[model samples]
Target: MADIATLFVAEGPAAFGVDSYQWVSLAMLVLIGVFIWKKVPGMITGGLDDKIAQIKQQLDEAKALRAEAETLREEYASKIAGAQKDAEKMMEGARREADAILAKAEADSEAMVARRQRMAEDKIAAAERDAVDNVRASAANAAAAASRSIIAEKHDAEADRALADKVISSI
Candidate 1:
């Protein structure tokens, strides 16, 4: 153990001394830093500019689309309003037509009812006239029969012959 410790102590300073390997490592580090400093910032700036341009283009397109949508909405709203007005006009016209038809039907029905009533009244009047004529004829026949019976009861055969002869002479 003691020999091993002594060997390490003897090599430590020699390994740390300025040498060809140290100079080469330092040169490599300086070259890498110089390359990054000269070229990397420009590449980063170009990438950022490209991304910003793309974002601006997308924003302009979105604005255009929104304006177009607003115009379409206004156009559609006006069309819907016109359609509604037309529908209301049609409905009003239909209602007026229906009312006219109903009024015509009512007038026709009233005229028909009046005609029927007049015909019925005429028929009733004719029936009453016929009944009156029949009563008069019956009364006349009954009076004639009563006169004949009274004459037959009052007179004998000879008197009846004499009365008939006289009635014929007078006529």
Candidate 2:
């Protein structure tokens, strides 16, 4: 009874008649043998390799998408720059046209003013000529009237007949 009681409480087997540690070791060995026979390690490693390949494929796709996005961004940027340049050129052209229009309008207005001034000067000259002609005509009419009155007052019928007889005797 004492020997059986000591065996139950003993830390190790004094002489090997299988102990609890031996039973646990035997169970671990059987489990390892089953895993090997089923090729569980190979299956686990293969699944992990497939997962790694899938992740690599996703990374490659992401890289390609990023590259395409970068290309599109650059293309749009260049188009925007070109559009801005075209807008600036159009604005410059419009400014030049406006300046030309303004200059032409100013020149036309000046020409019109000069033409109107010339027309007014011609009208004034014509009026002055008409006034001088009217003054000359009035003077000529007054002189003729004075000469007729003098001739009628200074001459008579008797003096006119004596001058006629003397002219006839000499002939």
Candidate 3:
């Protein structure tokens, strides 16, 4: 049984006068020749080139997107600055208008005060004139009463008749 197992052992040269190592080398050479005949290396290199082109195209697209984003950011920043300036201008205009309105209100109030003062003075002057007229009328009435009493005390009926007869003979 041991001899039978040894009969197929690889302890000597292989068939067709070639060793097993030489046959393996020959098989490796034929495989290399077949790969060269099929242009497998060119195909691998061409596939690598195509991948590199695709990656480069993607990189270019990324760069363009980055540039467009930067442009949009700058444009929005300028618009925000312009909006702030416009808001400040509007606030300044409102302040100026408020000041003008306040000044006009003050002027109107002062004019109204002056007009009221003048009206009060005119009323006082009219009251003074009325008081003076009343005093004058009272004085005239007292004088007339005193003169009538004096005339009645000095003159009599006979003196009046003699003076009347003298005046009638002269006419």
Candidate 4:
């Protein structure tokens, strides 16, 4: 620090009555005097204030835009949530309808099977009845033939006359 202060003092004596250090100081003072005379500091302060105000306005606009973006994001999120719920509801309804259709198909299949089974049972009963009736008719024919043979083989003409006379006396 002391060395810097010595640099500002008129310590050097190189030519032309004044020291080189004093000439540098004189040039520095003239530059400061010119700056003060032209009112450059006030102009600089005014320019800085204008820049700060412009920056503040930009910040305010950015804040307003950010708020609007947040609002849009929230609205879109709500809409997406609602859409997902609607999709789920639709899926559930479709599932219920599919289940109902499956149940109906199962019931219809069962009923059809039962009806076919009943028809088969009726056919079997009819076949059994036909078989029994055929057997009864065959038995009756056989019995009549056997009786005719026995009567034809056993009875002579005289025996038949005697049987007729006996039956007439009994009547």
Listed in order, each prediction's TM-score against the native is 0.53, 0.60, 0.58, 0.57
Give the TM-score (vs. native) of candidate 3: 0.58
lDDT of each: 0.86, 0.91, 0.92, 0.92
Model 2 Cα lDDT, one tens digit per residue, 5-75: 98878586533687877788988999999999999999999999999999999999999999999999999
Q: Give the per-residue lDDT of model 1 (tens digit) for 73-108.
A: 999999999999999999999999999999999999
| lDDT digits (tens) for residues 49-159 of candidate 4 | 999999999999999999999999999999999999999999999999999999999999999999999999999999999989889889988988998898899978999
Q: What is the C-alpha local distance difference test score of candidate 2?
A: 0.91
Q: Ten residues in a row with the worst lDDT in model 2?
A: 8-17
Clashing pairs in 4: none
Maximum-TM-score candidate = 2
Candidate ranking (TM-score, best to worst)? 2, 3, 4, 1
lDDT score for residue 8 of model 3: 67
Which of 2 and 3 is the better model by TM-score? 2
Clashes of each: 0, 0, 0, 0
Worst 10 residues of 3 by lDDT: 6-15
Worst 10 residues of 4 by lDDT: 7-16
RMSD of each: 8.2, 7.3, 6.8, 6.4
Residue pairs with backbone atoms closer than 3 Å in model 1 (clashes)? none
